[model samples]
Target: MAKIIEAFVDERGHLHTSPASAIVADIAAILGRVGDEGGLTSGVAALILEKRDAIEKAFADYDMLKSSGATIIDVSDRLRFQSHAE
Candidate 1:
């Protein structure tokens, strides 16, 4: 079966003190219940695998942008545009 690999977050969020293994165990339990409810575990796995590359790439791009010192301006623009669009 496919596995969820690493997780990445931007440097600003509050750090959770939970162990990584605990998080993985929680996800496994959730997926097990989802399967019991007629959700296809294999389908979920396949979809995640398919999109994994794009997801990782997007995160990496965001990290690069933050490292370049542009996140504040980027976030401001995003909020302004979203507010106007709404």
Candidate 2:
């Protein structure tokens, strides 16, 4: 059975998982609404667009994480510890 993963927003405002399609759609909608507001740095916009794929992948990996009962903190810690260990 396919598992349903819950999305979480941490204290830092970064998404715990890749934004779901619906979330991404909402963001795009909001960006469109504020498109003419100006003042956004090009680098920030480009960074967001660049991360689109990673965000999508995170959403796709959500099921895997849910099935394994892994938390973002767990993954983050493991990666950091492993990097230091090496």
Candidate 3:
């Protein structure tokens, strides 16, 4: 779960906080419920493991763009263009 967080310090030396999205919160809540009952189901664990690389890549991309000073609008525009192009 900590891996989902991608906090960083900016050039000004101020730390930026990464808040979990609603989707993440929902997933965590569901997982917590299942954990309380017992523990992670094999399927759930396998799914999380399968998605780990993609999740890590997303965090890496976000951190890279943030460190490069790219705004959300910039990423949105690029993604929009790529979607249209495809």
Clashes of each: 0, 0, 0
Clashing pairs in 3: none
TM-score, every prediction = 0.36, 0.28, 0.34
Q: For residues 28-59, what per-residue lDDT tens digits would candidate 3 score against the true structure?
A: 44555455464554346446655979988999
Candidate 3 lDDT (Cα, 0 to 1):
0.58
Q: lDDT of each prediction vs. the true structure?
A: 0.57, 0.59, 0.58
* Residue 77 lDDT, candidate 1, scale 0-100: 84
User: What is candidate 2's lDDT per residue for 20-75, written digit by digit as tens?
Assistant: 53354445445554335644433344456669798779888987888897755666
**Which model, 1 or 2, shows the larger lDDT?**
2
Task: Please report the candidate that would top TM-score against the real structure.
Answer: 1
lDDT tens readout by residue for model 1, 38-67: 456545644555577897898999899889
Candidate 3 wrong stretches, greater than 4 Å: 1-45, 74-86
Query: Which is better, 2 or 3, measured by TM-score?
Result: 3
Q: What local lDDT does model 1 show for residue 41?
A: 55
lDDT of 3 at 57: 96
